[model samples]
Each structure stands twice: as structure tokens, then as C-alpha cells.
Target: MLPNRSLSRKLKIQSLCSNHKQQSSLCASFSASFSSSSRCRGYDDTIPNLKIGKHTRVIFQGFTGKQATANAKESLEWGTNIVGGVKPGATGEHLGLPVLPSVRSAMEQLKPDATGIYVAAHQATAAIEEAIEAEVPLIVAVAEHLPLHDMMRIHSILSTQSKSRLVGANAPGIISAIGKCRIGFQPLPTFSPGHIGIVAKSGTLSYETVGSLTRAGLGQSLCIGMGGDVIAGTNFVDALKVFETDEDTEAIIIVGELGGTAEEEAAEWITEYKRRTKNPKPIAAVIGGFQAAPGRVMGHAGAWTGLGEGTSESKYRALENAGVTMVDHPAKFGSVMKDILAKSGSNFKKMEQSLAQQRRSFHSSSSPLRPQASRSTPLNTRQQRSLHLSVEQNATILKNYNINTSPEPDQLPKSTHFVGITVARSARSPCIIAAPTANPHQLPHRVRRYPFDYRSGPSQSAIKSALQHLQLDSAPVSSKAAIVKLINSLWTMYKEKEAITATVSLALSSENDDLIIYDSDLLFDDAAFKSCKRQQDIHSLRNLTLLAPTDLEAEAAGIMYIPLETPASLKKDGKEPRNLIGTLVNGAGLAMNTNDVLTLRLLKNPQSAYPPTTSANFLDTGGKATASTISTSFKLLLSDPRVSVVFVNIFGGLTLCDMIAEGIILAFKEVGVDKPVVVRLRGTNEEAGRRVLEQAKLPIRAFDEFEEAVREVGRLASGVEAKTGVTEEGDLDEVLV
Candidate 1:
């Protein structure tokens, strides 16, 4: 059920009015007008056909493999128009489909419109190149651990060609629910054919949102999982462009998370789009990681916010400034869209009834979401770690590259002014930010910035012009020369070292009028480690002490882990003790959502014994996790003394539930289960996974429902008995800003 209409109206009015503070009265008038008449026309007949449809012929690379065969079977069952498949060094048939020797051979014989690459990470580049050379229109790469250098090379190759549009190197691929076409491993039951279009960076989060929408009588027309890797083949803007002209898509939902400037770029495009289009579709966005700590990498490799522009707050403000409705959480997507449609006077009852019936029928079917073994093994974890250089190391590298560096901290004189130099991941070149402060961490209110080309370096005239505009009282000729040389040297070092981000803080000496580096931190590109010998040499200088012991263990075990509680948070000086629930989940997005939901629920129930509750750590046993990795993850979580209970949430796609269950059982036998375990398993091989756990009779409670599992975990953590009823659908209402 939807929230109260009055409350929804109040929230909508507040959001619309907040943006136009100067003209509140005018905004209110416009808001009233918008509610009554800004209805999105259901589907434009004139719009061209979508990129993927029912009649689109599809094929598979690595066709004879176990993963591809399983996925092909599911796609066929879901009514995907799969014509044939390609498997090098193999002939004949698999799954009643022809398996040719190569992509070109399949192209000549079958003329497939799309191809799904289920190949290993190391082989992904070659498979994609072959598909591109054959001019396949749509290519989906499902490998999660593709090396950064390989992706960079693929991007370069893609830029030179205009034929193929790659979906993901780490993506779940695309699914057209209305068309009954599935190219990737999306859970089929959660999707329904409707007028709403969905695009997101996280696959599991998309599934969760789609489930809510489906239950609320809303179905999606098209859904695209854009993958959460740092450098993806398709971005938010690319997906938005398709939705902009898509006739079947009446409304759009964007699920953006912290990381890159994709959300900012999408906001800029939407601003321009609204200016030109007469009737722009309403857009509601849910940006994840609102409570995420700074400098901490979330579940996704690309989810860390290193730059100010990549922060969740920054992305939200940008999207809101572009007039996009901001949803606080994914659970609210259905309600927000329903309200939007209601205001537009779109009839919701008939469509809702139809979708509800479709969902019921789909659920009643005997088809089970089963797990399939993947042909590819996990990639070496060493290549995934990014090398961070300390102050002394950064200074040495700068000097080695002929760049100027400040003297030691003890030898430096009193500072007059401070300047910050940084090259963000998305930045074209280095930027010099000037602020009036000694603290390097504080972001100044008003700072003058000089952005120059890294290739050309900083020019003397440009530096002088920028200095004259500085907010400081005076800029002497000597100070200007010192700043120029400093900027030039930093730019040279940044370019030569292949650094992803080079943050330098420098102080201007009052006596000598020279700029001396006070603190320096550098992070080099992971791709460079594999290709550049200099980077390999510099890799030896990495500060191993910076990483926690658990972090190093998780890396060795080939799983991602992050401790949620700091040492201070765990130290309950005089306050009520907090209980830590250790979590194990697959996929980066699901890991974040699990942590978020657990935190929110715990915060709401303050009367419980655990007044301040949190997770012990954030762990993601990658998409292709094996039973061994799962066992290792359990060992790591149990090793943390602060952890009170364990919660395992698995949404099987590439990672199978049966495999996860087997891993849990293995951990019980190998390490001895000491803590109470709560497991919520769903998707491929869910029934078998649950049966395995039940048969084992281990000290674990397995649940098929998400809310039930969460409730159980909370009950165990708080030492309180189980609750009877679940919260009403609309009761957990978050403010939609």
C-alpha cells in the first residue's frame, strides 16, 4: 500500500518549493500546475523500437561452458530469442543450439543481433574484440574481475569503432520484461512488463527495487544493470539516452551509488534535456551509501568517494538541482512512482490488477531458480589492490621525477598560505585549489582554482592570471614564480607516474616566499601495476601497515571486507554496549543494502538491549565465489571478538545459493560454529541450498523471506524473543526529498 496522500503531497510540495526559495509563491503555483497536468503520455507510437526486443536474435560466446549453458536454458525458458552460440574449438550442439567454432562463424551462420559473453575475466577482452569486429550490435560481458588495463584497452578499441555497444565487463546484462527477453542472469520473478523503465549500477539493488514496484502494481518496461565497476562500458547517461526516446517507457528510475561522476554527468544531461523536450518523463533517483564513511571503499570497487564531486551528498544536490526527485531509499521507489503517476491522473487500478495477476501466475509456475557452476576460476586478488604512497614516498617520487618538494616538516618555516593540488579520477588534468588555511583536510568555503592541461603543463602567464584572482590580500612576484614552478612540477609528476590521484598540500614560506610541500599522498592506477615497470618498482613502497589485519586476511581469501565499527565505536566507555552483527553477502550492492537496512532497523528499536547496533564488518564474497571462499569469510568474521552474531544474505545470480550453503556447512565443520547464524538465501538453487542447511542440522536459522531473516537477526542480537507481525508496507516510510 502507498503512504497517505496528504503526506506524499506535503513531501512533494516541500521538495519542489525548496529548490525555488527565491520564488516560493511562484514555485507553489508551478507545483500545483505540475501535479494536475504534467502527466507522462503512456507510450509514444512514433518512437523507434528499443535496442533489445522479443524478435532480437541473440547468441552466446563460450557457449559450451557450464555457466553459459545454464543461463541459456533460463533465457530460453523466459522466451528469449536465442538463435545460436559460439564456442571456439568445438562443433555440433549444446542445449539444442548450434555451437560454432568462433564468433565470426556464428555471425555468418546465424546472423545474431546480440551476444552474451560468459567467458573468464582474462578472456573477456578477446571475446569482446571478436564480437566488435563482427559488428554485433549489443554485447554483454558478465565477468566481474576483468583487469583494469584490459578494460582500458577495450575502451580504446571501442572508441575507434561505431558498431557495437558493450553493456558490461562486470554487468548482469539487460532484460526486457515486456518483451520476455533476458540476456543476463536477472531473477525472472521480480520483473514485470509495464511502462516504467529502470537503470542502475547495482543488479541486486535493482532486483530489490523491482520487487517492491511489482508488488505495488507497477511493472518495468525495460531494466538495465550497468555494473558497478570503475570503468564500465555503459554509464548512466548512456542508459538515460535510451530511456529518453523509449516509447514504452513512461517514467524512469535511476539507482546511482557513490563512486564516479556518472550521476553528475547524468544530472547535467537531464538539465539540458528538460530545456529542450516539451514533456520530460519524471525521474526519481536513489543514491546509495548516504551513511558511508569518507575514505572507505564500499562494496563496489568503483564505490569509493575520493573526490568531493563523487560524494553521495554532492550527487544528490546535483540531481536535485536538475529537478529530479530524490528518494531516500530503494524501498520507497514504488511509492514515489505511484504518487507521481497518481498526480498525473494516470489510471493505476487496471494496470496494477493486470501486473498482480501476472506476478501470481509467474510465482505458481514450477520453474526453479537453480545454480550452475561457472567455467572461470576466480582472478588473483593481488591485482585488485591499489598501491598507496605515503608522504615521504610521494616526496621521493616527485624528486626522482625532477619535481620540487618541500623540506622535512621540522625544517619548514611558518606558513603564510596553503594550496591543494589534486587530480581526481574523472579529471582531465590536475587542478590547483588555493585556500587560506594550515589544515589540509578542511575544504574552504571560497577557494580559487586553476585547472590546466597536464600535457601542456602550467604556463607562467596563466599562473600569474590565476594568482591575481586569488582571494588572498596580496600576491608578490616572487610568490607567483614559486607557485608556477610548483604547479608545473606537480603536473609533470602526476602525468609521468600514471597516478590515479595525487593530492599534495603545500605551504608558502613567509620569509623565503617559496612553496614547501607539507603533506603528500599518491594513489597510482592499478592498471599501471601490470603494464608499467616503474609502477611495479613503486609497488614495493606500499605501506602494508595502513591496512587492518582483517583486511589483509580477506584479500588473501579472495573476498572483500570492511569493518563497520572503528576502535572508538567499539569501546563502550560508559554508554550501553552495542551488539555487532557480522554479515556475509554476495554482490557489492547487496552488501551495502544489507548493512543499511540492518543499521536502520537497529536504530529504530532503541528500547532493545543493543541501544546502538551495527555490523561487525562489510563483506562481499564476489559474484563468482566458491565454497572455499565462503568458509574463509566465516572464519574471518568469527575471528572478530566484537561480533555477536552472523547474518548471511545471498541473492544468487553468478554466485549460487547452494554453493554458499555448502560453504556455511563447511565452516561449521572446519572452524566450529560458535555464534548464532541467520541465513536468507534466494535465487538460483535456493531450495537446494536451504535443504542442504536443514539437512545438516547446524546451529543456523534459514529463511526465504528477507524481512523475516532481518527480524530474526535483530531478535538474536537484542536477546529479545521473536516478534509476531511484520511492519506494514507503508510504515517504514522515508522522507522523499
Candidate 2:
């Protein structure tokens, strides 16, 4: 084992020698013997390992490009085996090397094992596909700004191919200090031969790591950038596997950033590797973006974090919890790795020897790229028959496997289903209008109603007895008090011969027969009414004074179900409310937020001449609302004489924007909306959904930002011009703020 104090001194000496004029000759000598001896002898057919070395021939796609020319020249200067290049056309020779027209042509000439892509964003995907078709063992993709869907396709193509391994779309690529090979743009002098293997997401971070390691006298055996894209060709786990088998890689240092689960996943593999090998090589990690603001894109495409997503703090905790040495600073990575190497050096060397010995006799004629067969071969008939006999002889087998071959079927729990109640508005003002849901899976019978009438002044004993009979005896004390209070209040009103249109949302708990009161109103509060409109628990208990109760009407609108024929009697106000602004949203929070915005806009711009009652938004279609349901909601809003304009504000999460867009289109077709509708759609599939609305040729104006949508709606309703229209995407800070 190396001593920590002495190692730092040795590192200083080596650093001096590496910078000397004769360092190139010294590096060449190390390279000649390093690549062969360091080539992993512990190759397992089961493990996906791409052992790259100095001898590996490399080809360049888009060799004619300026970026490619510069990088390729640097690679050649660093002793990289650059065989040929592919430029499609106008490429005879470049930099004393033959430049071919295609990957296939270049492959025939050079038989390249690896390729680097440095093409324009438009042609990057095609270049990668060409390299894959030619079956280049390793591909280091350095092209940036490739479309997200195109990158997904590239990953798919690589996944299907067994023999190939991909590095990056926006990566620095891989380097072997000992092998004297540089595939990507890594500062060669910063690297020194030692024992650390680095697998990182960011190219700049990897460079910083190499510098740190070199300074610490713990130079890398292999350094691979797994790309900064969300979906890279290769991941941290793949690179770790290669390092795990390499004899030269005594320890590993993973450089990760925020905004991906790659670091967390690597921690899981590190834990598993420790358990399987019993003596794993030490691993240290540095997770970048610790101080980065959430949802702010930090240089790379995949470096932005969201709520409960790949944050640096979360990733650090994950690795630390898995026993990995988590380095907070880039400069500390080398020192941390040096400390680990000092204590674990001898054990790592022994593990290397053991791994090599273990794989010496593991041979199969099948291709290494193909999955290895299971160790257990097919069982004989006798063995199978013995197992069948055991199953017949014992019930333990079924219990052990939780296999229910003949177990009793699970019984659905008993539930109370309240039947529809009749309310007399003349003397008996309010009553519950709920009937048992006639669902097939529901209990057979409905809950029987109480016979004690409040109008007749039933005895206290009868009232208490009725409560017991209805199973309200086991209800919560507060609920019982509420019921008693409601009954007394109703009895007082019944005596006075006064009527009120009471709206109450009912939720029944079958376990205790307790009714959960969500919301109640003597007079309708439009904001509260809209908020509870789509709640599954809400049952509008209206007084059915002069008509027979119906099941379909009761189920469709709950207690608030206004019949088409009973419009005159059901109208609470003698005249319709003027200049009503209706809102359509997918969630209660969004509904509330949009309502708040409208209220503020009206209060702030009193002179803009908005109606006093226009503050209350009339509609909220909760998260579960489908296109058909949303259409129905819009129709009802437009049907109202009070409503002049509708503002549809949807911040979609679980619900998609496309689905909402389709609903808006359906509503326009069904209701023929003539009113000015200001629509704002954000979140999942926003662009596609916006296109759906735009193509429909509807008069609805769509805004990308919430403030703009609200401002436009307010301006239209108040008969004024909208201020400024900003379509910039809202960030996490806005949501939080």
C-alpha cells in the first residue's frame, strides 16, 4: 500500500518530469508497454465492456469541417492512431491522411474500430447512423444541438446493436493516459499515468478532474465523458463496468452534474459491485451544480433540475449513502481519490488478480456481444416430475411463492349508498338529493331513510333512535353536533315558512358511516362553487320542493344538477350577472391562481370599467376532466347570459395540453363560441396542443405565459388594449415566487 504523505511528494516529482522536454519520449516508452499489459484479461461475455487502447484505429465523420480538422490534428499529434476520415463528398485527402466519401468506404480501407463525429447539427444524426452501420466498436459523438427526438433515435439504434459503445453527443470523449490515446479534445499534458479511472458527464468537469488527479499524483488509467445529454449513448454504469475489469484502473472517480439520475443509478451499481465482489475498488465522486439555481440550464442541455428531480444535493446524498466518497469541490476529487488509493491499494491489486483468474476459463463460442446463457441448464424429466410431486404433497410451495391456485376470492367491503331525498321548499326548505350509485360492484341494497320528521316535532328518543338506526351513532362527535345543529336550524326555518337554496358537498365514509362536509353555502360564492364543481366528493344537496326525483339528473350534476325544464325555478338571481368572466382550468391550484390574477387585475384597474361581479371566475374543470367533459363545461359557461368572455388557463402536469386543446376544439364545434376566448396552455405537450388549436381556425388567442393570458383576458373584458405580450417560457422561480 502507498503511504499518503510520501505519495504527494512523489506526485510533485512526477509532475516535474512530465513537463520536461524529454517527457514525450518517456510517455512513448510507457505507451508502448502500457496498452498491452493494461488490456483487461478479465473479459466476461456477460458484462458489456469496450476496452479501448492506443492501437484502436479511429475514423472521423465530417472530416472536412473546420472543427473536425482542428480536433483530428490535435488527436494525431498526441499519438492517436487516426486511420482515415468520411466527408461524403469533396474529400480526397486531409492532413496527409486519406479522406473517403463514406463510412463504408473508409471502413474498407482502414478497418477502424472507433469513430468521432464533428458534423453540423442537421447532419449529426445521419453521420452517427453511418458509423453504426459500419459497425465501429466505439463512437465518440461531439456534435451539439442535435434535436432531442433525433438523440433518442440514436440511443435506440445503439441499444439494438450489441458490439458498439457510444460516448457523447456533447462530450469531450475518452482518453487513456498510459495508452497515449486521445479520442476527444482533452488537454493531453494535464493527464499523467497512474491508477484512477474517470467517468464524467461534462467535458469541462472531466478536464478539471484530470488536472486535479494529475496534481495529486493519481493520474487516470482511463477517462471517459458519457455525454451531457439526457439520453447518452453510454452511461456511468457502462463506463464503470469497463473500469471494473481493467487491471490498470485501481480506483474510479465519477464526475456528475445535476439534472439526471445517472449519478444515483451509479451509486446503486457501486453498492451491488461491493456486495458481489466482496472487495470492490474504491470509488469517489464529484457532483457539479450544487449551488446552481433550480430549472436554470447550466451550460449543458441535461444540466437543469426540477422539483424532486436530479438535484446536486440529492445526487450527493445518494452516492454518500451508498458509501462513495462524495467530493463537494472539483479540486478535492484527486485528493479524495488519493486518500482512498492509499488505504485500498493492496486490496484493489488482489481483487484485480482474483478477477483475472476468475475469467481465465470462461469461454463460449457465441459472440461476446450476445447475452450469455444461464448457468442452470434445462432440467430432466425425472427432476421435473419430482418437483411436480413435491407441489402435490405440500401446500407450503404455494404459500412460499404467494401463488394462489385455489384461494378464496377477495370480498368487496360493505358500503352505504344514500337514496335520493325529496325537499319541500314551502315549509321544508332543504334536503339531500342523493341516491345509491347503481354500480355493479356496489353493495346490493341502499341505506334506509329515517322515519322521524322534524316538522312533526318528533320526540328526542325517536330522534336519537333514528340516528342509531341510520348508523350515525358511530360517527365523529363533531359530525353529530353538525347534524344536530343543521336539524335545529332547518326546524326553525320550517316553522317560519322561509325557503333557501342551500348548496352543500357531501362525502360519505362507509367505514364509520360518517359524512365529510367539504363545502356548504347559503348563498352561492362563484369562486368556491367553481373550485368544488369537479370534486368527486361534492354532492349538491338542493331542496327538491315541488318535483319527483330522478337518478340520471342526480348522478350527472350531484346536488347542483339543474334540469333543462326547471331553468326558471332554478335561477337564483332574477336577472343574469353582467360581464361574467368564466375560467377553465385543470387543477384547483391553477384555478385559484388564475382567479387571483383576474381579481388583482380588476382591483388594480378599476377605471378600466370591469363589472363588480366579473371578479368571480365561473368554471374550473379539474385534472381528471377529459375532452368531452371539458367541452360540456365550456358549453355551460358560454350558455350563461352573464358570461361575456372565457379565459382558459391550463398549467398541465399529469393532464396533457393536447388533450385540453382537443377539448377546446370540440367545445367550439358543439357550442359555437362567439365570445372572445383568451387561452393559455403550458407544460406537457404545449407546442403540439397550441398547433391543434391554431389549425382549428378558432378565434381563441393562445398565450404561452400565465401573466399574458390573464392580462389579455382582463383587457378584453374591460374593453381596452392589452399591454405588452411576452411569450418567454416561465421558469421555476416564477412558479415558486
Best by TM-score: 1
**RMSD in order of candidates:** 11.7, 28.0
Clashing pairs in 2: 540-559
Model 1 poorest 10 in a row by lDDT: 373-382
User: How many clashes in each structure?
Assistant: 1, 1
Off by over 4 Å in 2: 1-49, 306-308, 346-737
Candidate 1 global Cα RMSD: 11.7
lDDT scores of the candidates, listed in order: 0.67, 0.53
TM-score of each: 0.74, 0.43
